[model samples]
Target: MAMTEPTIVPESSAVSVSVSGAVVGGLRDVPTTTLADLLGRARVMDVVVRPLWQPVPRVAGPAFTVRCPPGDNLMLHAAVHRAAPGAVIVVESGDLDFALAGGNVCAVAQRRGVAAIVADGLIRDLAEVREAGFPVFARGVIPIPGAKSAVTPLNRRVRCAGAEVDAGDVVVADEEGVVVVPAARAEETLTAARARLAQEAAQSLDDWEKAHRNRIDALLHAGGHEES
Candidate 1:
C-alpha cells in the first residue's frame, strides 16, 4: 500500500473562515459565561487557557483555526498574516515548554487587525502585550520561544484546549472564559443567546432569586431531600 501525505492548508488559509458577519457581530458582545450556559460545558475551553492579562477586552469573531504540533509554532506564526481582519486566531498547540509567540508576533497581528489570539499553550512577553492592549488568551507564559520548523494545517478543525473548534466557528472570550459556538449553529446560537440576555436583563434580582429558589427546591424534592 502507498502512503498519502496529509494536505497542508494553503499559506493564505487565514482568510478562510466563512461565518456570516452578522452572526459574528451578534456574538461579539455576548458573554462567554452565557454562551457556555447555552452550549453546555463541552463547548467551553479548559480553564487553563485564560486571558493572559487583566482588564483584557472581550473578543468575538469567526475562528481561523491552526494546528501546531508540540515544540513548534510555525502555523500559528503564519496565521497572523492569513487571518482576515477581525478574525480570531485559534491555535491548537502541543508545546507547553516553549512559548508559541512573543511581543513582536502579537504586535504584528494586532497591527494587521487580527482580533485576538487564542492559544491552547503558553506565550511570552506579557508586559509588552498588555501595554499594547492586544488581547491574548493562553495557558501562561514561557520565556523560551518555540521553533518555527514544523508545518501544519491552517483553517481546519482543531481541538483547542478542551473544545473542538472548526474553521468559521464563532469564538467568544472574556474574563469568564472562552466558548466556541459551532459554525453551523452560529446564527441560532446568537439568536438564543440574545434572547437569554434580554430575559436576564428584564428580570429583577428578587424575581431571579424567586425563580432560582423554586427550581432548586424542585430538584431537591426530586432527590428526596426535605428542607428543614
Candidate 2:
C-alpha cells in the first residue's frame, strides 16, 4: 500500500459546532433592552455602531468572533465563509480610517444566512449595503480599504468596542445599541428578559407616571427640597 497524506481542516470549522441553533434562537425574541436590564446594564457595547439607515430591524445571534489587525480584514474574509448560518459576524478591527468590509461582503454574508455584521471599526459601500438591506452595525463609514498582510485569528475571544466577547456569546442589537450576553448566562438571561418584557407590557402609562412621580418625590425628599 502507498502512503497518503491526511486532510488538513481549518480551525474555524471546529467552532461552527460549539454553539447550537436552539441556543441562538432563544435570544431571537429577546429585546436588547430586556437583556441589558437583566445583565445590570453592564455588557452593553458603546453607542458607536448605529444602523446605516433608520428603522433597521433587530438582530440576535451567537457571535462568530474575529480579531483582525488594525486596518486589516483578511481574517474577516475567512470568517465570513466559515461562520455558521445565523451567526452574527463580530469583528474587532482596531481602527476607523479604513473599511474592513463593504457591500460585496455584505451580499455574500447575506447569502450565507448570516444574521448580521457588527464591526468595531469602519465599513464602506453604504449605498449598496443599504440597497441589499443587510444589517450592518459599525462605528462609522470610510472610503479607504485596509491592508491585508496580517493573518488574524478567528472564533476566539476578542475585545470589540471596549467589551470582551467570547466566540459563543449571544449578541443582541436593536435601534438602541448592542449587548453581549455570555453563553453560560444565556438561558437565565432569556428567562429574565421574557419576564421583564411581560412586566413592561402590562404596565399602563398612568402607572408609569405614578412610579415616576414617586421616584422624583423620594429624590426631592433626600435632597431636602420637597415641595410644601
Candidate 3:
C-alpha cells in the first residue's frame, strides 16, 4: 500500500486513447485472469468498500482517477465532465463517511460516457444507478446528501482501496475485487497478471479434482464400516 506524490494527468492523452472498456472486460481477460490466479497475491483490502453495486453496461478506454475530499463533490463533477469514455472514476473520500455521489451525478456520468464510479464513501439512490445500469462501488450506502462547493481539487493523487490512485492509473474491479496498476507500470503489470492467472487456473483444476476425490473416498470408507 505504498502511496507516491500526486502526478498531473493530461486531458489530451486520456481523450485520444482508444476506448478499451474491455481493458479487463471479463474474468477471462489477461490482467483479470492473472489476478485470479495469483490468489493471495492480491488483498481484498486493495478493493475498497462493499462489492454490492449493480453492473453498469460497459463502454471503453483506460481508467481515469480523481481524489476528492469527504462530503464534497465539486471535483467529482469535474472528473465526470472531463472523464474519457472508458474511464472509471476512483474517489477517495477521507474517513469513508458521507454520501458524496448518487443518482443525479451518475446520470451525468452516463451522459458523459464514463464507464464506472468507485467511491470510498456512501452513495444513495440505488434505483437510479441501477436503472441507468451505471456501475458503482462504494464503502456502503447512506441516505445522506453531499455539499457541492468543488472544494477538493480534481485529478490529484490519493489513496483508495489500500492503494495509491493517480490520474491515468488503470483500475479493474469485478466480483473478485479491485486492483490498481500505476500508469507507468500497467503494461508490465498486465503481462505479469496474465501469467499468474494461467498458472493459477491449472492449479485450481487440480485442486478441485483432489478435493472431489477425498470426498468420494471418505463416503466409501464410511459405507464399508456400516455394512460390516
lDDT of 3 by residue, 1-228 (tens): 996544333443432223233444532254433543443333233545545555432222355656667777666767788886767888887535567777888999988887788777778888888787787877777788777664455566667767666676666665656666555655555567666656667787779789888998899888784534
Q: Which stretches of candidate 3 lie over 4 Å from their true place?
A: 1-33, 36-48, 54-61, 95-97, 200-204, 207-228
Q: Mind sharing the TM-score for model 2?
A: 0.89
- Which residues of candidate 2, in runs, are more than 4 Å off? 1-20
Off by over 4 Å in 1: 1-17
Cα-based TM-score, every candidate:
0.91, 0.89, 0.69
User: How far in Å is the alpha carbon of 90 misplaced in model 1?
Assistant: 0.8
Worst 10 residues of 2 by lDDT: 6-15
Which candidate wins on TM-score? 1
**Model 3 / residue 72 / CA error / Å:** 1.3
Compared with the true structure, all predictions reach lDDT values of 0.88, 0.81, 0.63
Score candidate 1 by lDDT.
0.88
Q: lDDT of candidate 2?
A: 0.81
lDDT of 1 by residue, 117-145 (tens): 99999999999999999999999999999
lDDT (tens digit, per residue) of candidate 2 on 1-228: 996543323545444334456766877788777777778555888788677766788888889998888878777877788887888999887686889998898899999999999989888998998888889988888999887667755777888887788887888888888999888888777778777888889999999999999999999989899566
